[model samples]
Target chain A: EAGVAQSPRYKIIEKRQSVAFWCNPISGHATLYWYQQILGQGPKLLIQFQNNGVVDDSQLPKDRFSAERLKGVDSTLKIQPAKLEDSAVYLCASSYLAGGPNEQYFGPGTRLTVT
Target chain B: GESVGLHLPTLSVQEGDNSIINCAYSNSASDYFIWYKQESGKGPQFIIDIRSNMDKRQGQRVTVLLNKTVKHLSLQIAATQPGDSAVYFCAENPHDDKIIFGKGTRLHILP
Candidate 1:
């Protein structure tokens, strides 16, 4: 089976510029997640969606970062007026279920660099 | 504020030897734990997982051991190969349904 898919494996933008990343989760998976992984650090959960509705986004920076899972199959994460601190790899993952010990399959991720 | 952290930032082991990565979590309410392997330029890949009720779980050449009393979790890779060299992260599922991740340990395979 195919795993989660992400677009634009790498991106570069100037500070204060806007950038967006896209994710296509595995088929039939109910839970989709977006995470930001800084260099030498683990991925931090940015937002989670169960189908078309959001499940959690407490860590998301409301002032600049936003995400949406419109059809429940694909999602997009956007950062407006990106900053140098926002330089990190953005990962997308999917799981069969939301809660419990279900395993998650991750995409290749998009590496964003802000100049 | 519950958090997960690793005991060591980096570990080096000779090829063909076993490797063990340790992690400590502060949330006693966490019910599930998972180990993930992440290579350079790639996202984390699930290696093994264990539930709160179970102390251990094994898959292929990897094993996950959980100690609820100490709030510790470990991943053991037997007969490690060069391909096993990667950053390993421990994650926990708490009551809030969030999967919190540790900073991760970089495993280096020495030839």
Candidate 2:
């Protein structure tokens, strides 16, 4: 079976500019997540979606970042007026279920470089 | 807030040697713990996981030991190989739902 898919393996943008990333989860997976991985640090959860509804987004910067999973399938994450600190790799993962210890399959990730 | 942390930032060992990486979690409520290996430019891949009900779990050449008493966790690799060189991360899920990842430890295997 195919793994989770993400677009624009790499991106470079200037501060205050807008950037968006896309993710297509594994077939039949019921849970999807977005994470930000800064250099030398582990990936941090930004948002989580179970089907088309959000499950958690407490860490997300509502003022600058937003994400949506439309039709309970593909999803998108956007960071507007990007800041230099936003330069990090964005990862997308999917799981077979919404809970439990089920393994999450991750994509290659989109490396965002904000100047 | 929930957080997972590693005891070491890096570990180096010779081929055929056993390697152990350690981690600690702050949340006592976390019932599930997982280990992931990440290679350069690649995303993290799951290695193994353990639940609060179990103290130890083994998979392939890897073993995960969880000590809920002290809130410590460990991953042991037997007869480490060159392919094992990568960053290993430990994550905790307090409610078996959302996951929180540790800083990770970079493992280096010498020929």
Candidate with best TM-score: 2
lDDT for residue A26 in candidate 2, whole number 0-100 = 96
Q: Name the candidate that leads on DockQ.
A: 2
lDDT of 2 by residue, A28-115 (tens): 9989999999988899999999999999999999999999998888999999989999999999999989767688999999999998
Cα lDDT computed for each candidate against the true fold = 0.93, 0.94
Tens digit of per-residue lDDT, candidate 1, span A5-83: 9998999999999999999999999999999999988899999999999888889998999999999899999999899
Tens digits of per-residue lDDT for model 1, B38-105: 99878899888888999998899998999999999999999999999999999998865578899999
**TM of each candidate vs. truth:** 0.96, 0.97
**Any runs in candidate 2 off by more than 4 Å, and if so which?**
none
Backbone clashes, each candidate: 0, 1
> TM-score per model for chain B alone?
0.97, 0.97
| Model 1 DockQ, alpha carbons vs. true complex | 0.69
Fnat of candidates, each listed: 0.70, 0.72
